[model samples]
Target: MSSGMAGANTEQPAGTRRNRTSEAGPAARRASRATDTNTEERVAVWDAVAAYVQEHLLVQKGVWIPTFGSFDTISKDIRTADGTVTLRWPVFQLARNLRAMHHLGSDKDSLPAHREVETLKYSEVAAAASVTWQRGKTCIQSTVSLLSNCLKNGENVAFVLKDIGVLLFEGMSFGIKYYYDFLEKLSGKEKFRKVVFKAPWLLDTLVSRVAPVASLTHSGHLVVFPM
Candidate 1:
């Protein structure tokens, strides 16, 4: 039996063995390359989405999706039944049209009595907001042009945007500084030390709000937003 096995092994050609190895090597290499490409594509997509969310949603305070919904953050500090304090994060709620399309019930009951979620269609809201942003951009552009023209003509131009608290074309810039200083005084460490530290209840009131049921998670960290 051993001699028979030896004869069979000897009969197997080296060229055939090399051919099999060469065939498997290329196929395995192709499969590995394909897997790597897919993984990279997925990672790229995830990163893009994360960046968009960070910039528009988190930084800008809110973002509206074309077909899905809007996302916004709401800070809420609350005490649990056992007296443990927790901060509730922001969450995304389904749009009215989306909810209706999915046959989901209205979220009116879940919302706070004092606040109302806009029920406008996504397209309408997006269009309106886009127009507003465009108008703001146009105003800024015109202001810049006016400033340039004034400077070129050797004239002093003082531009002020009351909403943003900005004074431009002046020797002193106070708009952003004043705004930031006000915000800092309102919510910064000094404010916390003087106000919240002395009156914890006021801090609780400032951060506390009626949260919706959808804003909770099993691990206690609320997911407030739907993917």
Candidate 2:
């Protein structure tokens, strides 16, 4: 009778182990299914949003989607010896998504958060400027002044363009949007007749400290010479 009781006790443990295994199998399968469903839903959402952006916002001017990226429509003015032509174009932005997903994942947080992202293709901005803001009298004056100064004084003007923003020449860079506008204005009217960007760094350093020159001395307007 004692030998029989010992055998029964050992058999009970085996029976219990089988029961536990059977119970866990269904639970594990359920958990896996939940994870898969969640993944599918997230993928669908992303796909829909991407499609919407491509369909609607792709043609608008300066239209940017928050946290995802931006879309821009840019116009340009062409100049030939005979006449001028204006052209408009569009481009998409996706840098913010790439930066957020890949760069900012670790503890060493270097990239800005998604909310801080302000997306614009540097080319679009430059093209817009060439179409619009470059036409301003002040902008034209500044450009002419700087270019003239560089040419006259034999100063080396460096254009440091890193493919992200406007054509930044030398130490300072101007936005492409404004540059485009300036170009358009030049195409429409004769530039450098009134003002020119002859010496930007020098003018900035001196004008900031010295009294304002009423006009470029060569123009013969009442002016204060930088003595």
Candidate 3:
């Protein structure tokens, strides 16, 4: 991605900080942000931004950046009956959350629970807690814009999301092919010791929610009573 925003490591004044266009105003903030930048700064910003998104994603249902859109997962229920189906896709919806954030005029609907994920315990700093959020988010928007530039420049482009996938833009089409398989990403894991004693996994019903009526027979019949 191209150079985004400003220096990611630029130390701010030692005092209270907040997420806003500016303490002074949008015009002043815009003026304060220098136009000149380089690839290194953008990459730093992106790395920080990607880390922030990954953190929020693990704890919350989804996360939204004002201009970048939404980062969330698409889950599919997996049950014994629904045998073959699997694989939960980590989805990146372009500009959907931006419109929503604008109409609502709040971060309530857009962002994940900020205070819930702690920097001390989880080593996660919420968007409001650190400058990283805004800086990273700006870089995210810049990253998207970089992909958009391809269509204008007429070139095939791929944006690498570390540990996630490569976002491809070719022939005026866009899609993400993930290198990591978030298979059954949200599905509950079985506590083998506690659950297996009750019933073997094959016979367990409703994702360990309900008792199985019978064991599966060799002939594929239900045997309520073993003998």
* CA-lDDT, candidates in order: 0.29, 0.27, 0.36
133: Cα error in model 1, Å: 19
Q: After superposition, how far is residue 109 of candidate 2 from its true place, in Å?
A: 27
* Index of the highest-TM-score prediction: 3
TM-score of each: 0.28, 0.22, 0.44
Model 2: lDDT of residue 151: 25
lDDT of 2 at 224: 10
Between 2 and 3, whose TM-score is larger? 3
List CA RMSD, all candidates. 26.0, 31.6, 19.8
The Cα error of candidate 1 at residue 60, in Å, is 6.2
Q: In model 2, which regions exceed 4 Å deviation?
A: 1-43, 58-63, 77-85, 95-227
The order by descending TM-score is 3, 1, 2
Query: lDDT by residue for model 1 over 1-227, one digit each (tens)?
Result: 00011112222221111112222223233333333223223223323332343344334255544334444444434444444332323344444553443344342113233443333232332233343333433332332333333333332222211111112121211011112222233234454343334434433222111222111112211111000
Q: Model 1: which ten-residue window has the lowest total lDDT?
A: 218-227
RMSD of 3: 19.8
lDDT of 1 at 129: 34
Q: Give the winner by lDDT.
A: 3
Candidate 2 weakest lDDT stretch, 10 residues: 218-227
**Preferred candidate (lDDT higher): 1 or 2:** 1
What's the true lDDT of residue 201 in model 2? 22
